[model samples]
Target chain A: MSAIAIGLTGVTKSYGDKVVVDRLSFTVASGECFGLLGPNGVGKSTIARMVLGMASADAGNITVLGEPVPGRARLARMRIGVVPQFDNLDLEFTVRENLLVFGRYFGMSAHQIEAVTPSLLEFARLENKTNARVAELSGGMKRRLTIARALINDPQLLVMDEPTTGLDPHARHLIWERLRSLLARGKTILLTTHFMEEAERLCDRLCVLEQGRKIAEGRPHTLIDEQIGCQVIEIYGGNPHELGALIRPYAQRIDVSGETLFCYAPDPERVRGQLRGHTGLRFLQRPPNLEDVFLRLTGREMKD
Target chain B: MWGRYAAALPANAWNWIAVWRRNYLAWRKVALASVLGNAAEPMSSLFGLGLGLGAMLGRVDGTSYIAFLAAGMVATSAMISATFETIHAAFARMHHQRTWEAVLCTQLTLGDILLGEVAWAASKAFLAGAAITIVAAILGYAAWPSILYALPAIALTGLTFASLAMVVAALSPSYDYFVFYQTLVLTPMLFLSGAVFPVTQLPDAFQQVGRFLPLAHSIDLIRPAMLGRPAGSVGLHIGVICMYAVLPFFLSAALFRRRLMR
Candidate 1:
């Protein structure tokens, strides 16, 4: 088997005058969890669709599970599982029937589907809601069922687009656990998400996209350490340049977003000592993480 | 154009059956209600318009008025049943329920989903069309074994109407938009297609318009079959109905490819 699970080379797509994915390229190694992190409409979902062969890219090439996309995409898709952004479970079917119908789409036999249904249900932690209609399932249960349905064919590559979006904290944790289990079992996952915590937790490596272009790509922690340093000091509601000048001797980088000014440095104490006399400034110091790298790379502008 | 059509074809011919089965499983829950709903409208027209109106008018076209109307009812019922299934029910699956989007995520292509939907709609229309034919046969309004020939014509009519309605389904922005198709297209087509009256009775220009209507082609085949007479120009009638079935399918596929896949 090829080490590369998904490979995109200079892939570009345009809708009329607007470019959605522009000369973007990446590859996911087999059994690795790779995340595509970007704000809304940055072509994350479009890349996911192109990888699945649901949409054709205008330029360059894509291969999934060693099969060229939009050409042998059907064959490639037979081994690919997808957890779409929204819960699109069939409201007409019970929990079991949803899996049954989805399995049939992959040409799985009745016996094969019957054998797998119970285990998938168990994997999704929905053993008790076996025959319940999709509408009857709670939001979390519906999301779990959607994941379980995706696994019926035991696909080689699992593509999840914003899998945890709109999920409550508890539900989000449960999904993260299931995903971790899949990774433990050597499943290659290609995920697209806006949740920095999700990417930091689940992804082995990730890329940051802005305006349909790759800004940075590496391990989550490595990118954070390299891009924003070890510490982030947030000084809220003050003149950014005036406060930034206070820490200029200690801080490596200074950035302003909205009402807060961020001071990044390797040593927190040196930066904090500079603000010791600034009691009324309402500043706090913390370790830098993925969000700092994200906001720094992609900016804090709101994207609809 | 030919290349695009080839690309639009299902990857595997039989893969569409899964989509058909999905719909069948869903419809099974409301099977009785769905079947009754399809049959009730046509049966009422048979009773109210065919019998009541037939009594006053007596005989036309050298046969009883109700008998001539029975054939029209079969064709009209099939058309209406298929149209509603595609425009309203299939639209719900496509736009509101997002079932088609989910299906696309699988190995199935848009062509497979559409083929399944069109087949299912045609099947539903068959049931409604068959119910009228059987009732007419039982009531001595239609010829015995010869009326059986109308069954295939009815099914074909379903395919024609279902395929045509898919164009409307693909283009409609919401359920509200269906009213335009129903009012401006379908209801007008019902009267213009010579389903209830002979096209010969209309002005020559109006009669020319009827020749292009899909239902008119369907009636040309079905009415003769129901009346136990050999149909005239069977090749032309079948050719026109087949054209209606095929042409709009590609149109819908093109429209949906832009709207959904893009």
Candidate 2:
């Protein structure tokens, strides 16, 4: 079997009365891109911190790179690189300087860092930005620079938490592309994001987290097939309650709008025949995806 | 483990130059500012106390008042600066900058990092003391060739305080605790350690109390050199200074590793 880059079983973490991760159990295999998906306030960052060995778990075991955590984690950390959610790039240094210093922290020699720095710059698509002071760079440039720093160790397992957060569209896509390149290099990736499209595009397999628990886990397409059905039709043009009432007979699951209704079934087209007598009904049918799974699990409890 | 880390470092002479070059590039302004700010306190004391108050105190230890105060102030400034360097900057690195979090993650051990920090703070303290001596030169202190002795004396003083500061740093919860150390420990030592008056002036009980602090031996070793004279107890002074050196060095390393290291 390929190396297991990360593993956790019966892992629990808490803050005062709040149990953030309750007996959390999971693992990510080497050379795979795994996603940890959750909405806001869902302890995703807390889980990421624990994986990085920056925070203590209240109970249970955590292993990375085939070794028991904390003790083995020290060795594993040197081999694994982490791109934290916030961009804490050393503002005192230039973009290249940031990478250079990070390499220094790992005790990378000057020439070795020199050799790796250029490739990292190219990977982040900020080769032209090597000389710029980190403070002078734009938000996206700084974010990419932080990712470049994480790669200086050539980590076998790359853990990135919300790596593209607060970036422009172009910057976000650039970061996504860079992440994909790392994936192609046979690097194991553990990534967390709130964006469904990102999860769909990158993760080979994923786990959905809600309220400090794993709600579901599977590949994107399989998750969509099993977690949500063929399609969801949301009708918003008419009285949603009445529309919900009218569509209830046709849908396996009918969700209401004030004036329109969603007819969810394998054959949503059969809704046309069923709705033939109804007039001025409007709706849109879209494919099932992570977002639907997310909503179906979360139940819109004020994401906060 | 260390070998694996060093294997990756720049093996060439150019690489060492670059590491220090970057340190200088990033910190030169800080160096200049620190040197001036550290020297200024002694300068103000030289004018206010050495010149102003010395007019009444007259001769001390057979040297002019300004000259006597200058050498003592040199030791005081070095200790004070070194203390602040490790306490303020190093603790900030640990807690605020999260710098140490990034540092210890690498190939470097707790020992190497502690050594580097001690060396850095000590070197900065040496510069501060050197700056005060320049002011001593303009004031016509008898010491001239004594610059050689000044080097190790100031370094000893630096090591003592730097180690003490590191211990404080390991325990410090915030900047306020450092200010407390200054008020309670550093400030008292400056006035009590014979920085101006000789230790003999204090009571027998107080003088013996002063014997335990590192600065007492520090001033004992420094005064003769700055007076441009020689005294007995070279062996005793050297031994005490070495204790000052070895004790804090080991303690700082051990404490820093225990407190900050994983």
Candidate 3:
């Protein structure tokens, strides 16, 4: 096993009476891409803040890069890079100046920052827009620049919080491709995201969070297979109660979500055969995925 | 956790230079506009009150009215520059621009950010105060050599107001929250602190209250230096301004830690 890069032991945090992060524990190994998946207000961002020492854990302990957190946080921060959820780029500065100033914040000298500017700009595909103000950059471009700024220090571990939350598919894909290259070069990453597809594509191991507690955690494929099975059959637009009664014996588990019934089973053919003669009912049989596992673990209720 | 945070404070003093440098780099693009804005108000006040009002009331304190008003302008301008920097500009960076959040993500701690903000405000105040002093010297209201004696007091005035204003910044939730400080505290301080008129001329009770105000002590030190007269109660005045500068600095830091750290 690789050495641990991040470890939390029963960490708990609260604001006033509301417990934001309950007794949660997880670890990310070196060179691993770990994802923290959750809905809004589920303590995903709170965990990220605790790791970065922005918010202190009210109970238990946290360690980053083998150093105790909130104590050795400044030292750990030297080797850790962060891409926050919002756009905190300096709006008064040009794109190049943004990178340069961030580099300065990490105690990098002018010569060092200047040496890496061209390549970092090229890496973000923003060579031509170096002089553009932050307000002028498109959302996609700004997100890319934020990622590039995080790399200015050449950190050993990168923590990205909802990196592609508001970007277009093309923009998200571009970011994912860049992250893949970083991981290929042996950089450990801790990612928090709501997009299951992004987690399935990028994360090596991920944990699902619900109301500050860990609901499920494993390799994406392993969790999906263990919790959801091999395939899902979605049957819609029919007498749902009658169809569920007929499909129950053929499937391992069934979930009803308002005019739709999701049937989970190992073999799609067997389930499909049971509904062969059921006309006027639409059904889609496909392989189960991380979304199914996530819904199963965190439930289908909408969270505020 | 609080003990650990307090321990991190002393070792991080020089780290705030990065935040100060960052602000300087951003300000470089519009340096001329900012310097002019800082200097404009004090200059107009000096000329307007010194020449316009001086012509009516001649030599109230054994010197030309312009000469007497010149020293008060130095103290008041420094106070205003530092106050505005810490209150409006610092609050904007903390809440709206999120610049402090970006810097805190680095190795720099919250203490470093607070010190850097106070230092930067003092630097801007010093520049404005020094410029007004030079203008006063050219206008024949101040002796060139005596102005040098007042530089330390001017810097102390900057730090005092900056640190005091940071307490307001830490407590403020929105831009509109600043109006209370400006109206209730700053405007009253400007009038009662002997910046526009002498505290001795006020009624007996108000005169006693002015003795405790930071601005009154600042003007006490600066006014004599500008007129080339012997300074009175120098140790008491410096002691009061230092108390204002140092105590509020720690208070503001504690408040910021509470506000920023959840």
CA RMSD, predictions in order: 2.5, 5.3, 2.5
Instruction: Tell how far residue B234 is off in model 3, in angstroms.
Output: 2.5
**DockQ, prediction 3:** 0.66
For model 2, the stretches where C-alpha displacement exceeds 4 angstroms are A235-246, A254-264, A267-284, A299-304, B1-25, B104-115, B134-147, B167-177, B202-209, B228-262
Candidate 1, position B72, lDDT: 88
lDDT tens digits by residue: candidate 2, B1-262: 3322222222333223323343445667476775677788888987789888889988987778888887788888888887887887767766777655555444334445555566667777788887877667766774688756767888878877777787788777788878888889887887678897887889898888888777878877777777777856777766776777667666766565445532
Pick by TM-score: 2 or 3, better one:
3
Alpha carbon lDDT of residue A104, candidate 2? 72
Q: Write the per-residue lDDT of candidate 1 for residues A1-304, one digit (tens) a residue.
A: 8999999999999999999999999999999999999999999999998898778889999989998887777788888899999888998799989999999998889899999999999999999999998899888898899999988889888999999898899999999999999999999999999889999999999999998899999999899888876678888866877877777778777777877888877787887777777756876878888889998787652211
The 0-to-1 C-alpha lDDT of every candidate, in the order given, reads 0.88, 0.74, 0.87
For B1-262, candidate 3 gives per-residue lDDT tens digits of: 5535752353454787887887788778888999999999989988998889999998867888888888888998999999999988888889878888887778778888888888889988999999999888887889868878899999999999999999989888887888898899888888788887777788999988888999999999998888888899999999999999999988888788888877
Better of 2 and 3 by lDDT: 3
DockQ top scorer: 3
Worst 10 residues of 1 chain A by lDDT: A295-304
Q: What's the i-RMS for candidate 3 in angstroms? A: 2.0
What digit string (tens of lDDT, one per residue) describes model 3 on residues A1-304? 3399999999999999999999999999999999999888899998999998888898899989977898888888888888999989999899989988899888899899999999999989999999999999999999999989999998999999999999999999999999999899999999999999999999999999989999999999999888876678888988777887887777787877778888887777888899889899898988899988887776762211
